[model samples]
Target: MVLPGVYAPQEDTALLAGALSDESLPPGAAVLDVGTGSGALALAAAARGALVTAVDMSWRAVWGARLNAARSGLRVRVRHGNLFTPVHGETFDLVLANPPYVPAPLGGRRPRGAARAWDAGHDGRMVLDRICREAPALLRPGGVLLLVHSALSDPGLTVGCLREAGLKAAVIRRRRIAFGPVVRGRERWLRQRGLLAPADNEEELVVVRAELPV
Candidate 1:
């Protein structure tokens, strides 16, 4: 159930949601979902009895998630703003994110409409990098962060970023998925930049779990 201009639940969302379901959530665990487009991951956490707060930069997404959560009776608090900004100074027991991570050409204006949901800067680490850098601050000790993105954006780089920020991080899930429309449209540019090769129509996706020391 996704609204227009909002990112829909897809393979990556399913992978992350499945991971969330397997976790042993503490009593009333506080969960924050950054870049919560359709609130899919956030809803998963809420289902596990987590007190979920979801934030997104797009107002449409914020409302869509709020409405969806309400209909599901999930009690998610949805906010509209850039990642981490809307919930300033609030720490959580868990942080979850599915940020934009598709590498695209540089030198364009900010992505519009649904494109803003996935068009990351060249190398595809723009939003993911920011999440890695800033999310740790919103986590209490013993807190964990679950993040998902395409391997085309470099999962190892994400691990490195999280570890550098003082978290123990590792890849918890990896899957190969065929390129979606966005990637297919930008294949020529990706190949030109050596990020993709001829005949490459698929990419690997990864979920990294980063946790602070107990």
Candidate 2:
């Protein structure tokens, strides 16, 4: 069950899960799920025979994930920490992330409370950039990272950053979803910034896959 402040499973979650399902996981592959709010992706990986570890900055999210894992009878090591900190000095065969990518107004104070789940600062790359910078070091040779975010966050930049970091990255999945409450709420700001057209009622979500070389 999702805790009151935890991010619930939505299209982005399903998109990442679909990518995980398509991957050919080796026997007992080690998988890391960053920002694992409700532990859905961690549980999914565990159900597929993976040794999964999930981390979240929010204690509520960590507890909720553990609860969900227990209820599902899945063995996922859920920890409370930001991004990759909880899994430091370790590597995984696969890493999954569905970080906050919604662009909040410029110069706004950093998100607090539940807003932390989605109100990314400025260009919405606050969390995404950190993940790109740190994820490669946590991947075993040939390990893959699956990340999902809105096109508004600039997927091309993500690919470029990963490439510069020595990983082959590209957008492997795309889905156009109707504007959610967050986007709708920021309609004027987004349009002023040209992130959305006045008539645009939908946003395209993209899943980027980056792979480490052997």
How well is each residue in 1-214 modelled by candidate 2, as lDDT tens digits? Answer: 9989899999999999999999999769999999899999999999989999999999999999999998998899988887898889999999999999999985968899999999889999999999999999999999999999999999999999999999999999999999899999998999999999778889999999999999
Give the range of the ten consecutive residues with the poorest summed lDDT in model 2: 105-114
Instruction: List the candidate 1 regions with Cα displacement exceeding 4 Å.
Output: none
> Would you list the C-alpha lDDT of every candidate in the order shown?
0.88, 0.94
Model 1 TM-score, 2 decimals: 0.96
Q: Give residue 98's lDDT in candidate 1 (0 to 100).
A: 89
Query: TM-score of every model?
Result: 0.96, 0.98
- What are the runs in model 2 whose C-alpha is more than 4 Å off? 106-108
Q: Give lDDT tens digits, candidate 1, residues 1-214.
A: 6888898888988888877776678869999998899898888889878899999998889989998998898889999998899899899999989889999886756677788889898889888988998989999999999999998898999999999999999999988888889888998898898888787778888899999997
